[model samples]
Target: MRAAAAALAAAVALTLAACGSDGPAAPAGGSGGGVTGDVTVFAAASLTESFNRLGEEFEAANPGTTVTFNFAGSSALATQITQGAPADVFAAASPATMQTVVDAGDADGAPTVFVKNQLVIAVPRGNPRGIAALGDLSKADLKVALCAEQVPCGAAASKALAAAGVKLTPVTLEQDVKAALQKVRLGEVDAALVYRTDARAAAAEVEGVEFPESAQAVNDYPIVVLKNAPNKAAAQAFLAFVQSARGRAVLGEAGFQVP
Candidate 1:
């Protein structure tokens, strides 16, 4: 009789589990659902994780809506937007990059500050080199990687370094922030200057070193709907979601400072 009762309970439990009464349905990928349409976003590389989660939420909130992203260095993404890329929105890691898009008339409205980020020294976990400050990165023996000055992170790095009046040659001038971070993660370089959010995002593989110079180059992340958006309404809604309380919480959790 006990065995029979256990089997019946198991069957009932299985039936309830299938009904989703215990928890919400798993989203196609991550989180929120609403209107159905396709919206393309050109975002900075540093925004990859947070934006991906945001995309899932946007899609869930707008049922049948597809939120696609082109995540790259802001400079590259800005160039694409200027070259007539069919993007529904633009979320740049820096205001300078966003202004480039707006100045080109590629965006529809004034850009809004969704989040802010700062630079940090990214070293492999355990910091094998025993490096701590900005000055340590300038050591002749350290193989440092930095983004090219044309990119957002690169520009910020340059400004921060200049604020300290310390100049050091990097072993490589990576084209983008992620690439520079990767150089450090792959043990190809001893150090790299990348966004604080990115460093935190890669916490398992890297340790972020906070330097005083970073305060001199805080980056403002701006987001906006595009002029040629195929689904402008959906795009605006998605942008709104990023500025919403839930969105702010998600971004903050990812190490971004909510604007």
Candidate 2:
């Protein structure tokens, strides 16, 4: 009788547990949810890989949420956001670029600096040209690529070059960091000026040449939720996740400086 009663009690406990709020059922909008809805993020190209990874992690944590990123030059992204593109968040590679958004009254609040990146020369895996220093970029023979002067990476390159008193005549002015890096990968150019994080993330395809002058051109990455965000709650939640331990781990592993 005692054994039968104990078995009955165990079954009743299991039934109650299954019916509780902690059951396997999803929270809202389905069987999985913390925040649901799509979030569009306009970020700099340098944050492409890291932000994409972070987006996946955030979706897993928040569930029911979808992350869509528009990665390109910070200036371009800023222009797009101000031009009426519906974006939930904006993460720029440079503070100046971020201010463009805030000045336009498109940003929700003061942006937070999440990471910092420095410039580096991205060359082919073998670095066949044997480009050694900043001076080598102006050789006039090595097909070098540079970012468009208006972009953050280009601004940094300009500062670094000005400090060194060297002028680099590039074969192409890429629209974004990835485009510049592409010039090196496709053998279109011998080298390119890109963020160190970009080179590290693309280590499988390119090699980074560390020069001393890049120190003077470090750029900070700032993130903010837009004032007209499609999903303010989701955007804020995503921003917090990016500054969380997991996000920091991913960004640090990608070679970004923690802010």
Q: Which stretches of candidate 2 lie over 4 Å from their true place?
A: 1-19, 23-33
Q: Tens digit of lDDT per residue, candidate 2, span 59-102?
A: 65544467888999999999999999999999999999999999
Candidate 1 C-alpha RMSD relative to the actual structure: 8.3
Residue 60 of candidate 1: its Cα lDDT? 52
* TM-scores for all predictions: 0.87, 0.88
Cα deviation of 258, candidate 1, in Å: 0.8
- Residue by residue across 1-259, what tens digits does model 1's lDDT show? 3234434544554676698655345344333433446778889999999989887666555445667789999989999989988999999988888899999998898999988899999999999999888888888999999999999999999999999888899999987788999998899999999999999999999999999999999999999999988888788788878888889988999999886
Each model's lDDT comes to 0.85, 0.84
Can you tell me which runs of candidate 1 are displaced by over 4 Å?
A: 1-34
